[model samples]
Target chain A: MNDTFKKLFSPIQAEEALKDRTKEFLAEKTQRYIGVRVGKRKHCLYAAVCACLLLMLLGGRWVYFTPITAISIDINPSIEMGINRFGQVVSVDGFNEEGRELSSTLNVKYKNYTYAIEQILNDNNIAALLSENEIMTITVIGPDGQQSAKILSGVEACMTERGNAYCYFATSEEVAAAHESGLSCGKYRAFLELRLLDPDITPEMVRDMTMREIRELIDSLSDGGQIDTSSFDNRGNGHHGHGGGHGNRRRNGRAEQ
Target chain B: MRSEQETIRAIEQYSDTVRRLCAVHLKNDADTEDIFQTVFLKYVLSSVSFESDEHEKAWLIRVTINACKDLLKNFSRSHTVSLDTIIEQPSRLPEDYRDVWEAVFSLPQKYRDVVYLHYFEDYTAPQISRIIGKNVNTVYTLLNRSKQMLREKLGGGYEYE
Candidate 1:
């Protein structure tokens, strides 16, 4: 019975056409096996490209908004402008009450640093002070890098037309110490000189004093002698001369070198 | 999913055995083709690790039988084969082989799997019990009854034991 049954079933074979059809069905169902792999790879590539673009956008925003140099303008209103790598003023901060009022009136945020300084000098109140010979000081404070030198040069060029304006570069350490005493960079330099002469002056005494008042105090304390201008100009690499003689200020572009 | 090479190799090796199991349970070529697709496609997608060639063959047989039974359970589709197709199938065989084939298929569905696995495939009752998911003693009864039926149909001239 077993031999007979084997012979009976032996003749039954699946035809080539049936096997071929079934293979075609499986191939269709499984996406030819390669399509799935290629699809997954394409998805991964798109995700990678999107991540790269997002990182670049975030990095670009950081680089554009971060300040590399600060320009402190002190006449009576002591205001500081933060300058980015591209020379744009990204921030405006006032060190005194009058400085805050002046900063609020000037629409200089996001403008080029040179343009912002020109705007401040051209402000009606500031222009009136300059005409009256109220000593105005413009200080560039940052690391002693090429960017700082470039900023100082730009500031010097901007101030060449004004006789009493002084443009000096100071180190970040000097400026940080100045901020601790609640003074702008220019006022801080004057305070350091005043401290040497009086040794009893406090930051509060000169906190609201005009730059002209501070300069007059320095000149008086020096006993009509040549005040050592070294303290005023920390980085003496560029533009280091003093506008001497308070009353003899006709056109002593003495600080223009 | 399995790779293409592995699936094709499995198709080439087990397609014949699957067809025979389909023949034992199904009535026509369309149903047989369904069993083939279902069984082989399952093999491709399944991650089962086979111990040997025989293990793979038994797995295919079990899947094919289940596929055939599921197709038959669908009452919406016709369960009967046409007389013409039935006649056409046996006409290709020699007279003695044709008689045996007819006698085997004429048995009930429950007896056909046991008779095919025991007599043709030479599986012991325990192996058939494991493959078909039946009790061993039940498989023994089925094999005995199927042999008696085949002998009665083909006439008591051969040793069916």
Candidate 2:
């Protein structure tokens, strides 16, 4: 085996690629020590890029264990969360004013995902929005994808345990409302269901509509999913003659169905 | 810095050895070229003095192994190569030796290193231990494992050293 292996090893000497590239390969390997010339500059750049990329590749895994993490939620209130490896809150912020105010007050750095969100939403003013039946969306994200999904489910469970139907609501009602009214999961879908209740109501007006206004809309639709459109004149806007008000209004105006 | 004449002489004398060592271990054309260039560049720029030609050759072999290891660690994982990749448009190596070479390359890196150094480069297990930074016992164990693996891969027809 040894003699045969030695005979075979002779072919390892047959290098054809390095035959003509001797001068060029040497120029590349030693060009840094020699000097910087025009031709060598591109080689230098390529070398620098490769070095930096290798360093980044090595650093990428080490960075995963790093204690600091950031999570950005893109709901309308759009909160950005900076968290630590232990799931402690570093900071909570939002791009919008409402998100900023809610995140700033009742602030504690070391807290779990469930408690922090519960406290923030429990604020009197924030709770007032939900109690008054306004449409709001809260998305919870953590530092990375795995962490984000974990935090999302955690916060959703926390809200549900408190009997707060305000958050974590993707029941058949919302899904059915979405299907009937042609909307999806977020607040926009909720707005469509509200649209079926009152044709004259605009999005701007929907925001200011009290819980009573929303509840009446919900009550008007019996098990059949039909709205009584008769009470539209009594409370507010009275353009009630045509239930076809959906045709001209910008929201669902193009009733593509 | 060494003179240009010295650089040319070293390249002519040792480039083939360096290239061969790299090929036997790496089996990748691009990687073999890298080690080949790196060893020659070190010869050109190195300031260390050797007591004799034998000393210089040993030093070159050690550096070649170290450079190959460094390049390999930088990779996310080791990539395997078929013997056909090495014998592209082949000019030598009879079919019997070719099959053994393929079996050698397919062994895990640790075993392959000692086997290449022992059988191909004719380094003893103790010499391989010093060059590869492994213990003497470890080198022997690796060499044994390598022989068994190669025997299995090549259907146990070949004899061991």
Candidate 3:
């Protein structure tokens, strides 16, 4: 039955009909006439301009600033972070902090510590901060209280400022260790790093705050949180608290911190 | 870079594929010709270059499908020829072939596009994915679902040769 159907519906060679039509079309397109060619030229010019304008509009230049922004973060020290115009982050690093790269293991910190980092992440309303390079800015705050942030350009270059403590978010080895060791959240330093980097966040406060408060903070941050420093043109320029000056800068920066 | 003559030759060679694709979609000779001309004109005017004949053919097929879709949209508004009317119109073929074509034409635009690209154009799911700008899994699922629908429409009795 299928064979019969195939034979009947298979493409037939209407070769002569196609060839004759092709010859006619080729002739028409190539034909030259001495009569007023200005109209043709004018039409061509108009089409070219329209095409150029359309290309310009669609050529990634006509930035439509969407209200919702997504940001990606790479937990890999070797990878860079990227922030799109819409504020979505895309990280492209191969490894996380525990020395494991792409392993599927989930690193276990203490329940409270894991809860703390998760709380900050949840409170900030981050879209998704996987160990990928989609994040706009990555703030690596050390266990010793020092902090630094870097914007990743590409997947290869680890572009960081000098003297900054670089820590990948979660390595496979760390994740495996966390899982096997059954370490409590307090044992994980990376989780602590995330807490310190978040200005409104503190470990002790997690015990005090309800889940709703934590969720609300995350929602607010996700919906254009006051903490987004990437939107400011002069981030970390030391321009304190006035409009176009240090005072306004300090106020805005402090608000996020 | 290919010369103008070479591009023209390529178009001439693949004109039949373009015509068949248009014919299958439009089901009207005049409309097919219009789409064919538009597709070729696009090829002539386009500054894009293809790495191989297969690439050029794929681009032409995609453009032809898009042109056919545009014509279908306009036809829906100004003309009253429904797809069912076209499918039911008398053909000289046997019932099974007629039934298959009818089912093909009756498919929704998305499903029909995948089926036509797969069966008529002989494109693999991955190739269809690239041509239609869809994920491989999506193309695979569309093909599987479309084929099942076609089988159901055929009363599930016919087996492929």
Candidate 4:
């Protein structure tokens, strides 16, 4: 029966086949060590390629992370940031003009998210662009979801410390879907109305257009017999009635990135 | 430490045993593959030399077991392979013995390792202890306990030492 057990439970893969895969795996790892996998006929080429890869890896380690984790902030102002293991901001992709300005303003290459956000918010140009009243949504994303949650909490605390009540936090994939559906920006009544008014309107445009400007456009469009205003009361009606009241974020398909 | 051809040769000779160890010990295929790849990678890069091929094989078994334990310790608990995976596998085992085979798998991890090395790999208790970094007496105790548990689950029809 022990013989039966030996015959029965020896692993299923044949000796030759598994060895072939392990050989392939080892060959691939050589590339990590020497920058190129050793080749039989092209030894010189392999050496050159390995040298180049080694240099590139050593050189770029300071500038980038090979396996990166990033955050996408979607609200009316859109910003995406990539962080390295040291918590330095390595890449920043911002969509709004203010966000773009923020991208340029926040040139600190090696600061944690909290410090980076604090610096960006304090920059004269970026500070001038921020309206404490406007809701801001931050989404943390990375290869590791648990670490992303920790980053999201740290970022939310940073924002809260700055006296921003309208700040919200979410995961990257969730915010990505929200941005795709136009719900993230639409959470803002004025921006949602603007989006309803023109789907192509930019976040900068959303920020520039006042509630009065949006209401006038809707009223004009209503009077012109192009749109209906009573139904415009759908979601944006509250902004006009209680502009000062702090409203809980409505989910009617709105997302802040 | 060996040339690429020599490394590949060694990998070809020992890969199956290393992989079997991983599949038996790890929770899922992906983690198993990770340890599998990592073990070979370590072999290719390591400077250590052996007196004979048998020593090389023993080193790999020791390393594979350590790598698996390290990964398990550093990470959260892993999701093990499902019953469906075991049932669907195209194994050499006779249909009647597959359930008993899986029952051995259901043993506590330490017991499973002891039973697998003792019964399938044909290692003596002292050999198993040396490979797995445990006392020889402890290996025999676990092997006995594992056999008792398997008997209860699989019934007395399956013979045991």
Candidate 5:
């Protein structure tokens, strides 16, 4: 039966005309087959390019929003700006009641830190405070790195254009301790000096005091009509440069030419 | 889609096997042509990668069988075609071979594929099950019943192996 069946189907070959006709049908159906592969390759290429662009967009967004250094400006309002590596202010945080009000009114987020500082100083309320000899301390808080030094130098240049303001650079650890005490870096530095003179002074007592009031309190509590210059200058890993402020220059008498 | 050269190579390689499977299930030249074009056109458009020549041949066989079944099941083609013209060019066959062919096609439509794949194509029962998407026991039963039917129709002298 197997041989008989083999012999039966062996003679029934597909005709040559049938093969020719099938080839023609396939060529017409597939557009000679070349068009389909090219179309598929183009589709794959487009999808890959779109995926790469999406990844780059997300990566760029992450890079732009990540802050590497912090600048704390304390003039009783006590607002801090978080600066990215690109020197843009990515965040503005208020550390006190008046600071929240000032932070809310400022449209300085995502601007360069210099422009943001200029906007703050140009505000009518801050300008009035500076003219009244209210001490405005601009503190740049980060590691003792080039970026921090650069931001501190830029801030000192801005201070030179005004009066009754100081520029300082502090380490991240000192700023973290300041945050734990619920004080910005500038007021926290004053509170540390005051705590050395009179150990009973608390951060809450200093949180509501103006920097001028804190400085006067430090001078009044000291032993010989002067606060400890060591506490004023060398607290943690930080350094200060006094600008042209008549009240501060005569009071502390620590100015760097 | 496959390249033109690949499609042509596949057509030249598998056309005869596809034609034989179409003959097992189909009744006319027009239906055979439709299955031919449908099967090879699917090959041209399909992205399936075959591991070996045997795998490619099995795929074409399965596709041709299914295409023939689809054409036969259509409402317009469901009417019975005459059994005398079942095998194309039946006049060219010898009387003994014609008797065997007639007996094989007479064993009901369900058994025709197993009979052809088993006796002619020399496929094992398990291979037929995988190709036809049926249980191995079902394929064994169909092959047994088809052999018995052929034995009865063709007489006891011939071995229905």
Candidate 6:
């Protein structure tokens, strides 16, 4: 067996073949994520529109208005309609019941957090609707507890499925007016009557959760029961045997570097 | 700001070198490919800009080694393939060189990676050290230990000189 091994083992072009296979594998994997390009372009369009509106609204007063506008934009715009779930407004490609034009955009806000909504828009798949005349209905639930509704025109759409708070924005006449009045900018927007779909749990929360926790949560959901937490040590000192700790340390070290 | 196509081309150009480095360290095709893809993907996502081809190449090697270590951790029974199985697959290498290649493949993954980088990839100790994120002294020691292991595995038949 030893002699056979020695005889079979040689330095031929195995290295080159291995290299070629590696390249092919990488090429194939990269192509899967490359489709994000189209999404990115759409996001750029949304961002451009938002920036344009923001610029117009703040016109000649951008530097002075930016901070105030930033603060006024609500942190969490989502309404948790149920336990561990929330709702968001999505614009689908269809006509309203009245046959009047319908358009949509996501309205997401998460408490005590802010994200670059424009970047999020560019990362996901969103369809554009036709119809020169369309309107989006926004109902603002003010922080001080007053509710107001308005019709928004020239609305663009985007989506978000994760977070303790919603992360969405729109650029419409109503939204602009709300910002101008500075009364409705950061207020909650309810879409219950519009019958929008529930917002997806934010990726940030899922990402923040430990792998084991997520696995357990998924398992519990699958089995329809409370998860077993006895195995989970609050100190995070569970005996992972070999490799786990070392690997985590190395990964964390690299991330820090 | 560089286009994705430009980035892909640059990565493709160094694919072979990166693979060889990974193969040497991993001593098997499966692990090597995993490391190779990971390294390239990381490069694509990173905001760091490279000054030149040399800098890019160095970065690729470094990232490849780091990725290899990462794979070693998550490497479950399901993911690991025997080095013997990888060697037995008849593909490109000629029969005469098969012995040397097999011997290299049989070396422990750590030693194999260091030797491949130093000898096959033509990297000096300092460069290998940087790529592997180890000290220069450590790299030299690893190379020496790896050469001893290779010589022992090759037995009396092959001559390095």
The best candidate by lDDT is: 1
TM-score of chain A of each: 0.77, 0.39, 0.23, 0.47, 0.71, 0.18
Give each prediction's DockQ, rounded to 2 decimals.
0.43, 0.25, 0.11, 0.23, 0.51, 0.08
Off by over 4 Å in 6: A1-257, B1-4, B25-35, B78-84, B89-91, B156-161
Return the TM-score for candidate 3, rounded to 2 decimals. Answer: 0.42
Off by over 4 Å in 3: A1-9, A12-15, A30-257, B1-8, B75-79, B82-96
Instruction: For each candidate in the order shown, give its overall lDDT on alpha carbons.
Output: 0.82, 0.58, 0.47, 0.62, 0.81, 0.43
Residue A182 miss distance in model 4 (angstroms): 96
Residue pairs with backbone atoms closer than 3 Å in model 1 (clashes): none
How does residue B37 of candidate 1 score in lDDT? 95
Error of 2 at A63 (Å): 52
lDDT of 5 by residue, A24-78 (tens): 9998887787767778888999999999999899989888898889999998889
For model 3, residues B53-143, the per-residue Cα lDDT tens digits are: 8998899888988888788788454267666557643264465467677777677778877776676666789999999889999998898
Q: For model 5, which pairs clash?
A: none
Per-residue lDDT of A86-192 in model 3, one digit per residue for the tens? 32332222223321332213222222222222332332222242222122222222121111122112111232321111223333344344334332121232233
Model 4 misses residue B70 by how many Å? Answer: 2.7
TM-scores of all models? 0.54, 0.42, 0.42, 0.44, 0.60, 0.40
- On DockQ, the candidate that comes out on top is 5
- Give residue B45's lDDT in candidate 1 (0 to 100): 75
User: lDDT per residue, candidate 1, A1-257, as tens digits?
Assistant: 77777778888888899999999988887788665567678889999999999989998888888888999989888999999999999999999988999999989888999899889989998999899878788888898899988888898888878867887778889899999999999899888977887777778777777777777767766664443344333321222223346443223223321
In candidate 5, what are the lDDT values of residues B31-105, reduced to their tens digit? 889999999988887889999998888888888888888888886775767655576545555665878777766
Candidate achieving higher DockQ, 3 or 5: 5
Error of 4 at A12 (Å): 1.6
List, in the given order, the native-contact fraction of each candidate.
0.68, 0.55, 0.20, 0.50, 0.78, 0.17
As a TM-score, model 4 comes out at 0.44
Model 2, span A65-167: residue lDDT tens: 3435443322334354555656666677544455566566657556765567667567787577556534334433223356645555565565553321333
Question: Candidate 4 lDDT, tens digit per residue, A55-168?
Answer: 988878754653255655443345677777656677776655545766776675666777777766677643443453433445456544556556756676666544322334
Decreasing lDDT order of the candidates: 1, 5, 4, 2, 3, 6
The local distance difference test score of model 6 is: 0.43
Question: Residue by residue across B18-119, what tens digits does model 2's lDDT show?
Answer: 776786567566777777777777776787887887677777887988888888886553556555666652335576665666677678767777887788
Sliding window of 10 residues with minimal summed lDDT for model 6 chain A: A146-155
| DockQ-better candidate, 3 vs 6 | 3
